[model samples]
Target: MHMVELKGVSKAFGDVDAVSNVDLTIREGEFVTLLGPSGSGKTTLLNLIAGMATPSAGRIEIRGRDVTHSSASERDLGMVFQNYALMPHMSVFENIAFPLRVRRLSRQEIERKVNDVLDLVQLPQIKDRKPRELSGGQQQRVALARCIVYNPALILLDEPLGALDKKLREYMQLEIRRVHAELGITMLNVTHDQDEALTMSDRIVLMNQGRIEQQDTPEQLYFRPKSVFAADFIGTANLVECEVSAVNGDRVRVTGAAGAFEVTEVEADVAVGDRVTSVIRPENVEVRAAGDDRESTGSDNPWIEAVVKDSLIVGGVVRHYLTIAGDVPVVAQQANSRSRLLLSHGDRVSLRWAQNDCRIIAC
Candidate 1:
């Protein structure tokens, strides 16, 4: 069942449309992330669902109840913001207990709830410490504990880990994922970090210019983007300009910098002679030996001779920047294995990939 639905939702500020004709559904236990750059309308959409801002158009439904006109407090949703929003004067226990107290819960019940949440977030020992006394990661966990203590059916997290250091941010990503899995509540998160979205979300809604460009699972969005914007936004991709040629069977021929290569892959409605963009992920490209035969390669193979320009080894992954035909630079990533070939600058290599690896967009 969809716990939340946004029907034709739109928000306007003066003459500008912040969220335009957006329709989305969140299932009862799904974690969906609104991912985009700042001013791309991700935050605005989250606000609409939270009832912090009224939509200029469309309806919002939470648990089959109309919430378009409801106030934030009436929505029964937990919201965590970029700022921890912790009271400087309050202890961790007090902060976690505040939400329940506002609802007028009994003193015994509030104590039990706060204790359970503190344990759930792994901060049971610091319940007596003030916010200033806690580390950044611990403070963020306290904020999360406070939000979930009341067991709200819906949770909205807006860059909740934005202020943490890099290592802490990565650790908190796993913590957030663990919480989402354990609670099984509908969660809608807004974040500009692509890696965070990919790491935590079941599905990602990529927004651009106040409109939804694409919404799909992480694998779908990364491997089969519907547009050039979607391709470039989700991950590192090499957008090569190409032209469509003959449509043979299930594939289409695309011409690019190297030469006319036969590729039988597409994700959009396009025809022959159309000017299209080919999206090839860096990790998809394979580096082959110089004497490799074209026939030995698959029929969908697009092979070109290139020279290794630079290399970087980060986190046990080999990142190779290859210059095809001496000028056009392309990138390929390979796993770090016990036996790996080292390609240095000016080393001649063959860049080969199966035709099905190419994804066509636009035109």
Candidate 2:
């Protein structure tokens, strides 16, 4: 069953359209993320789903019930914001009990429910502490506990970890996923951080300029992006403009500013003489000393002579930035190993990658 469905949904403010003719369906208990850059209409679409903002057209249904015009309170959604919206004066216990109290739940019922959530969030010992006494991560946990205390059918998270530091943010991503697993509630998260979306989402809905650029599982979106925007935005990629020189079955040869290269797994309707962009992730390209014999490296792999412009060691990964064909730029990421030869600045090297690692997208 679909927990949420939006059909031809649109939201406009005067001449500006924040969300434009979007159709999306979220399955029950699915963890979906809305990922995009700022002003991409992700937040506006979340608001429409929460019923905080009314859509200009189309329909929204939650579990077969029309809620397009429902008030925020009527949507039965649990919302968590980046600010950790806990009452500063309230103890952890009181903050979690607020939702239940609003509904006039019996005191005994509220106590049992809040205690269960506290244990689920692994903060049973902090019930007596006030929000001001807790750490950022702890306070965020309290906010989350409060949201889930009533077991709302849908949870909306709007940059819920944005206020935390990088290390805390990383830790909380796992925590959120754990909670989602335990509760089995439908969750829709909004964030512009690609890594966060990649780590936490079962499926990522990438938005751009009030439209969905693509929606796919994280692995598919990263490994086989359907568009240039998706390829560039999801992760670091070397996008090379090329003209299709030849096509043979699933394999195609393309010549770019960096030189000739062959790419396999051609899924697009590509033909000879067509302009296309070949995308290869930095980690997929291997760097070897320029003097290496062609036969030593697989002959079928594409190799281009490049001069290393700079090299940086980041967390045991050596990133070599090279200039191919004099001006065309490419980056190769190699794991630091005992057998690896460290390439220094101005060193001439060969960049090689398997044809299957490269994706050809229409220009």
Candidate 3:
């Protein structure tokens, strides 16, 4: 197995600690994304693993060997940068062939490797074209092809599709996934795009201010965040302040602006009369007619009455901002074409969601 492990890795520049005591592991052939905003140390941590920078503390292991102090070349890693890093004067063929040439492979060997990689990235037809002659997506593919031409132990992509427009960027996400599957190589991607992370990763490492916030599968990170920051960052959430009324066994009653909401036991421990924030994803809140007799499907359902303030068509989903009965607003989402009700801006609505669907996040 070619899994990677970082044991308490830390990096600092002067008084600023870029990466602080971060420990992580990547299983063989798994595609993991390091996700966070700028300066969150995602890129720094990737660089440390790539051997472009040394960790101030902790050890980095590849497969089962210590590679903490190894040089970038010694690490046998394929790296693709945000800038594409193609030689301006070289054609795509020569550019992809450069890595193999560095290892002093014979001319025949270099040509074979370059041709195979170009084919793998679906850029074989453009091999003779220069970087400027190719489209943004094609150039990005060339860069990726160059990285994996030598078949490195792991591939590190640092915002490789950042320069492309939205449509092309999305197309590249799928293309990258296809390449990863074909090669069966462990991929470590650093990106700030939550959707991209959600779309492509087998697991996501959520980073914040030089520390790791949480690490889990994409579904876990999106639905069950461990902190308020994780909930807010992963997607749009309605933050509600609630006063804990009582706790009995696995049930807890919370009084809030929307009304009394009963939440089933989450992973958190709480006491009576404690103020807390409960987060509900917009997509989780169900929107129906205000007067509709919403039969209680289960004992764990939390229901609230709200009015639709506005409905927006965001991509394929309809995002509805709701004004609850008590003047507390919450955002709700519905499938753009899933509902028969013609929801408009000023329509009154009722929202219902199960207790397990809501996450009790700390404010």
Candidate 4:
């Protein structure tokens, strides 16, 4: 049975619909992320699931029990917010034991659970310190420990790491994943950060304008997006407007500002004369000197002539921005290596990628 299920769930405020007819199922032990831009209904959906807000329509079930109208306190869920939400006057021990105390667990049980969770979060020694005395990361860990100490069936995190710096945020992502792996609890996380969603989620539900655009595993959503929004939102993609010129078996030829290109594994129902957009990731594109012999490349990859507009070495990879067919912009990312062709502004280069690396979505 699924840990959480939503059937046609929606929420509206006055005349604005925050979430609309959304259906989702999260299995036990799965880490699912609701990811999108602000006002895209991701957070609102999370709120509905947490019972902080009532849905205007539809039903919600937690472990097969309908809890659509249940109050937040009655739902038995653990939640972590953007702010630590710790009581400033309370010590870490008190904060972590709050839920257990609320349930009227014996003092001994509360102490045992609190100590275990603090150790699990690797901050057992700081139990006597108040929230104000701890670092931001430590405070966040205390909040997480408090959530897990109660042994709730579901945990909801709303931008829980939003307050941390980039480096600390990245560290917390790994830390959260470790905790989830150890506990095997169902987690529903809300965030507008795509990188965090990709790094932590077993599955991601990409939402937009009050509805789910796509839900799939990280690799599937990144490599096989079904819509333009999905392609653009998940990562950096070069979406070129084109028209289908011909179709040969699984390959389709498209003509656009970048010139003629062939795409394989056409999943969308596209045919000749149909307008489409070619979605290709920057890393999938390969760059070479324009003067290199085409035949010598020894591949059927379709090549486009472009002039290097800019280049930046980002750590271990070089990002090359180019102009194709005048105003059309394209980017290629290549590993920084000895044999990589170096290109500068105004340098002419040939860009090519495997036919399978590109996908088409009907415009």
Candidate 5:
């Protein structure tokens, strides 16, 4: 079933358009992320779904019920925010129990539900501690527990891990995923952090300038980006803008600042002398040094000459910045294996990738 659906949703703030016409659907029990850069309307869209803001136009349905005109309390939703929104004087148990108390549930039932969620969050031992007494992660866990205690139809997460340190944030990502899996609850998350979105989402709705730029699985958004923004936004993408020189069935030869190159993938109806951008992931390119006999760069092989402008070690990978064909920049990432030859600046290299590895976008 469609847990949450938006049809032609648009929100405007006077002269500014926070969210333009958008159509989206979140499946039952699915984790969907509204991923984008800052000021891209991800938060606004989330606010619209949360009923924190009214939409200028469109329809919203939750679990097949129209909720466009409903208030936040009328819609069954649990919200976890960046600030952790816990009452200072309230104990963990009280915090989780407060929602049930508002609903006028039985005292016995609130106790049962609060204990259950604390156990679910693996913090049953901290029920008596106040919000200030718990650590940041613990406090966030309390926020999540309070959210899930009522068994709301959907949970909304707005940068829930943003306040934690890097290590704690990473740990919380896994913890949240664990909680989601155990409860089988649908989650809608808003985040500008691409890694967070890519790591946690079942599907990503990438927003750009108040519009839905692309929506797809994380892998597809990274590897098969349909636009330059999607390619550059996800990860380390080496986009080579080339002018189409020739087309041979599925193969197309394009000349860019990096000179002429042939890729066996091209958009249909692409004619000669038209400009097209091709996306190649940095990790997908094989960086063989100019004189490396281990990999032959013969005429039949697909290879391009590049001069390494910079090289650095980033954890387990070595990133090399290369200047190809009149200063066109391309990045190549290689695993930091013991036997791997590490190149220095000014080292000439051959960058090669499979024809299928090149994603040619018409736009």
Candidate 6:
């Protein structure tokens, strides 16, 4: 059975629609992430499924049962929020065991379950300590332990790691992935952090303006986005507007203001002669002095001449911003190494990329 299903679901506050007609299904044991910007309805969608809020229209089901009108508790699901909502006065053991006690489990059963979860969270030693005594990561784990101790059918996370620092957040990303692997639990996570979504989710549901723009595996979403928005949102993308000049199965030739180019063929909502955008990552682009001997010469290798507009060195990567076709802009990133020359502003350069690395998407 599908772990959770939403068909034609939407929610609105006054005239502002929060979630628009979203149709989605999650299979058992899948980790799905709802990702978008601040106003993009990801949190609202999570609330709809958790029964924290009712949808203005359509149905929601969990495990083949309709729960559109059910209360959050009646849905038999557990939620972890951004705040790590642990009781300040309660001991870690009591916090993890509270739900089990409410369920009327025997004393021995509660002890066993609480200990097992504490161990699972790698916090067995802190069971006697109060929530405030633990570090942020530990408290987050304790909150997670409390949610999972009762073994709910589904686990919902709403930016569970948002409160931690970058280092701790990255650590907890793997920690949560490890826990999910061990338990084989179906998880639905809501977050605006694309890096977090890309790092942990099995599939990412990209939301835009209260609507689902695309849902796909992380690699697909990054390398084969279906629209200019998806291409730009998931990561850094350089968009070149072009019109289809030729199509030959795996390769497509297009002409744009940046000049004619060839890219990998993808399913286009529009066909031949239609305008499309070519998406390429900065890392995929090769930058060198104009007419450099390293620039390949072939019908398959298309290169454009651009003048360096600006340059910045971020960590080990040198990012060069260039303008081509008069005003059209593109970015190229190169490793900061001895062999790589840093381009100065107004320096003439050639930018080239593999045809396979260029993705064509009609927008």
Give lDDT tens digits, candidate 5, residues 1-363.
899999999999999999999999999999999999999998899999999998999999999999999999988999999999999998889999999999999988998899988899999898999999999999999999999999998999999999999899989999999999999999999999999989898999999999999999998888777788988899978888888898888888877876676787554468998888988888888888766756534423357889999888899988888988878898988888896657888999888777777777786
| Candidate 2: residue 20 lDDT (0-100) | 96
- Between candidates 2 and 6, the one scoring higher on TM-score is 2
Q: Give me the overall lDDT of model 5.
A: 0.89
lDDT of each residue in 24-61, candidate 2, tens digit only: 99999999999999999998999999999999999999
Tens digit of per-residue lDDT, candidate 1, span 1-363: 579999999999999999999999999999999999889998899999999999999999998999999999888899988899999999999999998998999999999999998888998899999999999999999999999999999999999989999899999999999999998877899999999999999999999989999999998998889999989999998778889877777788887786677666687767888999888888888887566554433465656888988878878788899887527778988897766568788888888666878788874
How many clashing residue pairs, candidate 5?
Answer: 0
* Residue 196 displacement in candidate 4 (angstroms): 0.7
TM-score pick, better of 5 and 6: 5
Name the regions of candidate 6 deviating beyond 4 angstroms.
Answer: 248-250, 269-272
lDDT of 4 by residue, 148-241 (tens): 9989999999999999999999999999999999999899999999999999999999999999999999999998998999999999999889
Task: Give model 3's TM-score versus the native structure.
Answer: 0.94
lDDT by residue (1-363, candidate 6, tens digit) is 999999999999999999999999999999999999999999999999999999999999999999999999999899999998898998999999999999999999999999999999999999999988999999999999999999999999999999999999999999999999999999999989999999999999999999999999999899888888999999899988889988777678888877877877565744579888888899998876864767466755666788998999988988999988859899998898888876788899887888888888886
Pull out the clashing pairs in model 3.
Answer: none
lDDT of 1: 0.88
* TM agreement with the true structure for every prediction: 0.95, 0.97, 0.94, 0.97, 0.96, 0.95
Give the worst 10-residue stretch by lDDT in candidate 3: 294-303
Off by over 4 Å in 2: 294-299
lDDT (C-alpha) at residue 10 in model 4: 86
Scored by CA lDDT, what does every candidate get?
0.88, 0.92, 0.87, 0.92, 0.89, 0.91
Model 2 is weakest, by summed lDDT over 10 consecutive residues, at 294-303
Clash count, candidate 2: 0
